[model samples]
Target: MKAAHFYLLLHVFSTASVLVNAFDPITTTVVVSVGAALGRTIYDYFHERCDPKWISFNVTGLEVDLENKLFGQHIASRIILKAVNGFMSNVNPKKPLVLSLHGWTGTGKNFVSQLIAENIYKEGMDSSFVHVFTSELHFPHPSQLDTYKSQLQQWIKGNVSNCERSMFIFDEMDKMHPGLIDSIKPYLDYYDKLDGVSYRKAIFIFLSNAGGESIIQTALDFWKAGREREEIELRDLETLLSLSVFNNKKSGLWHTSLIDKNLVDFFVPFLPLEYRHVVQCALAEMEARGLRPDQSVADQVARDCVYFPKSERVFSVKGCKTIESKLDYYT
Candidate 1:
């Protein structure tokens, strides 16, 4: 007999035997009938369907290292949490909010954008503190900043309406010129405006390549010291951001070398230490995805990544201060 027929026959025999001896006929009849129906349903449900991979909080057992790296504790998760928490904290029971994220290249800044939005927005598909009104933001070529700027302005003005604490993140923002920065000006609009781009809730984020100049310097040094032309263009973003000097007292903004701008150049500097989180997060993400970065080959690249430590900060161990940690990292 087939599996279903066998199950039905066995259940019928068991029920007949139970009824023959059942002390309480009313309860036994009801119970045996329910068991026969449930078994058939369970078999049909589990027989041969593909298991769906639904992502949820309990899915990944790898607990996030909140304080995992040097720039400070919980740097990456904080940027995500800040935007999400801000939205969740103020979401009215009756309204909707929006999130906008932009990325330049290499940093995988787009990944974190998804994480923040997914975690908070999961509360409900249609009603949550945040929404992915536009998930990916792309800048036009650096030469045509105005064209892209006009497009961005229209996108922001159109998507965000009637909400508070919206977030706009410009990932790998270091690539574009300062001119694009003006697209987002402070207004009563929901977007978070920084430099000139906008997102909701007014918390504008610009994720740099890290140290533009330093990365360039190291890349040049690697080329001259010397590798062939094949390795000049690096495949990593944090390494590029780390090479650029975050301060301007000595060498002016790194982009100035690429673009002939005469502004005070606070566009890059005004960003807080959290920007480095973008770099660290970028690194952690690569490891998670099993994208093998050749460390020896990337030594120059990694060197450029951490070259932009602020004046007030240095490598230190618990209860001790030292540059040895920095040396250890490079070595």
Candidate 2:
């Protein structure tokens, strides 16, 4: 063993030995028990554990990330902060904290999830407690929906059994088999336990482009009326988002009970990115790559992206999705 570990063990045993000789039998027993617990705590501190030592909620970090890293998403930034803060602060939640993110690609749906993971898990996305499933890759065979359902349930149950604070992110929900996700409805519902497993402390995030059209339309309408995008609020899009996702047949959430039962707590809308936001993404990517921020390179990268509304070119066609690759070309 390492010298430090050997010394720690020696200290614990020597301290216990001293207590045993100095105190009565009963007192000695209590002291030894306390010593063991302290040793265990020390060990846990040095090692990775599923408890609070490894998982902590940092609302401040999350807030700062949403404000600084994320761009052109006032409504998303606000709802995400409040929703996550409230959910994480609660000692006993009725059900798993469910957030369904709907928007165009690269609108920060995945990035927001990453930020939450980073603040909660010491390992962030690499945490064993955090699981990601891409519908197109994980559950590609629609004909095997039954098998996929079984595997998904087992996966979730087994993981939650290991760590109640587990997080599951489902990407490309629009491509998932319609009824496949409903398999885990029981876990998402308000129940003390489903066959001896409590999922109340878990978090489930669904990412999909199912409602991008409605979200874009809403933003377009605001822009046409010469209203600031910041003026757009959750109230203006929540109902529309839910309806759009529910009615869209291709959406994996299409009439899923996860929605019908009101298990989903929030349907976050990511508005399409404008030219300025794309430029911000480029600059951020540059900084992330350890390069000095160059406005000229950022502008060139942003310019390379295709914009929509041919005449006006108000919004980026691919949002900030291609910013990284485009930046590589310019830089």
Candidate 3:
């Protein structure tokens, strides 16, 4: 035990020394040191292997709970769940699993992303291997495009090199400047070798409201035509969603080679939530708060939500975005 502790200290110190010498900024060096330490801690906990009990936990249970938790959009939930299972099943993939989630303001894009991270990562959203970058938070200034580009690339490369199974989530992709997302093209490239970084094992997720209008329109059309919501399959809206995302000038990947190269594995569309979905969202919030389920409160919260299309009554335009606050206010 003493010898093992000594070896661990020696290894950590040696790695920290290398990082300190390589990075000039004390902050960057410190971050690298901390990351190294965390990596060692995680390694010691799992003994250099992923926790099987955690990884192999019943995904079906996750799917069922997500279905109950996230109101409506059953198709989207199933598709995403299946994709996650498939991607994680691969021990080492040749190409990274890239998922672009497109929908409206509160259509569960961010919520579902968090769900995925939480289930797969032991630390949930706080997992060191999971990195989230919001447009306004990380690359707020358009003028710093060049700096952001280099920094983004280096960040991905460094993290992936450290842990190939790293997951990268980019939120508010619509708010990101055009041409900036291309900086990540090399990592998402199919060549298998980019700047000596093997990005194949990494997972990339982009959340955006770019194709919200189109998705809502499709759903509205279906509803008006008296078509069952269950019939709306991925085939019904995949092309239009992808085109809208690529054509939208405000999108980060607008006119970028990432779309042209067809690197994105799946374009999951989160449709607008209905009144019933809002009620479910309310119930979910209530359950999360450890409060007993109350149909009256759920109905009240759902009624308080604003729906879209003033002329024609549709579902909650913002999905469950504001339902929590409303639930709190009501209950």
lDDT of each: 0.39, 0.92, 0.82
True-vs-predicted CA distance for residue 247, candidate 2, Å: 0.8
- Model 3, 203-281: lDDT tens digits are 8999999988888889988998999777899988989988988999988868878889999988998888888888888
The ten-residue window of minimal lDDT in model 2 covers 40-49
RMSD to the true structure for each prediction, in A, is: 15.4, 4.9, 8.9
- For candidate 2, lDDT tens digit of each residue in 1-331? 4889868876886687677778988998898888788778666656766888789999999999999899999988999999999999999998899999999988899999999999999989999999999998999887899999999999999999999999999999999999999999999999999889999999999999999999999999999999999999999999999999999999999999998989999999999999999989988999999999999999998888888888899999898998888877888
Candidate 2 overall lDDT versus native: 0.92
Every model's TM-score: 0.35, 0.88, 0.83
Residue-wise C-alpha lDDT for candidate 1, range 158-275, written one tens digit per residue: 4444333344555544444554555544332332453453333433444454453453344345445656323433233233332343232222223332222221111221112222
Cα displacement (Å) at residue 321, model 1: 29
Which prediction has the highest lDDT against the true structure?
2
Model 2, TM vs. native: 0.88
Could you give the candidate ranking by TM-score, starting with the highest?
A: 2, 3, 1
Candidate 2 stretches greater than 4 Å from native: 1-47
Give candidate 1 regions above 4 Å deviation. Answer: 1-73, 76-83, 91-111, 123-137, 140-143, 161-167, 187-204, 211-331
